[model samples]
Target: MIGVVSNSRHASDYSQGVRAMADFARKCLDNWVLTVNGSFEQHQKMIRATLAKRAYELFELRGREHGLHLEDWVIAEQELVHHNLNGNSSGFCILVDCPRDPGIITILSVTSRSLLVFQSRAMADHNPELIAVHLLPENIHPEQTAVDAVDGVLQVHLPKQRNKRRK
Candidate 1:
């Protein structure tokens, strides 16, 4: 009887620990943001490659059917741009490692599809100007988005846009 009681207690403790760890992770990710290099143009290339891959998968799913390239591409976009592969709707968080001191930070634009940021450090002798852009996987409310810089890390909290259907 004592052994069974100890096992039950241990299981309860383990469950509590798991919950606590999940809560800690969520809190840590609350201020998470995606950081990008100075190369903004590369985002386009990456998007094209990803889209191509998804489109090809659609083609294979269609039993290697041809002449549906445009349709496949559109379908792929609808699948990927709206929802991630995992289909989790809790929003997305990406952490970007930055310098200890990022200097003056400026946000150029925040759209539903992407974010454009400009950072400048006049005091620095090298690379005084840097432009970074991050492409979002889902549409977000531009007005509701919050951007902040903490400890040289840029944190962007993006709230996903809700879809409303009219009756």
Candidate 2:
């Protein structure tokens, strides 16, 4: 994946590393999921693998009901060993296996985090009398949002698809 940034005064190598991590995430999600404990390096690794896996899979699971083989995707994991205060040096690091939405992904493997997210989304989406967009969770900043303190299949509505009901 390509890296996007608008700051030259930031850690350029680190930003590049972030993209590299995203690329890795796009490739080896499962492994990254298993790793990535909480350390910055671990988080970067998981991010890369998650990005790699999701972008690669696009969440399609039709062929595997009867048992289809999954592909071993590999992202070009380049090293970012530079750190400059004024450059914002950036790159990708990867753990490969862990994901925020493991339930949908766990069709290929079984993981607790993925399962929880998948189930949470599925329930929110399936619940009727509720707007669809609200069903999908959002990454609120500062640990806050309009739906603060909401739980049990949250009903969030996206502005673009108002009144639309998701499956």
Model number with the top TM-score: 1
lDDT of 1 by residue, 120-153 (tens): 3424332212234356777766556555656655
State model 2's lDDT: 0.23
Locate the minimum summed-lDDT window of 10 residues in model 2. 127-136
Residue-level lDDT of model 2, residues 16-68, one tens digit each, is: 33223222121222211111111244334343544444434532444334322
Report how far off residue 141 is in candidate 2 (Å). 14
Off by over 4 Å in 1: 1-90, 102-108, 122-130, 148-150
Q: Give each model a TM-score.
A: 0.37, 0.19
Question: Can you tell me which runs of candidate 2 are displaced by over 4 Å?
Answer: 1-38, 59-149, 153-167
Residue 17, model 1: lDDT of 23
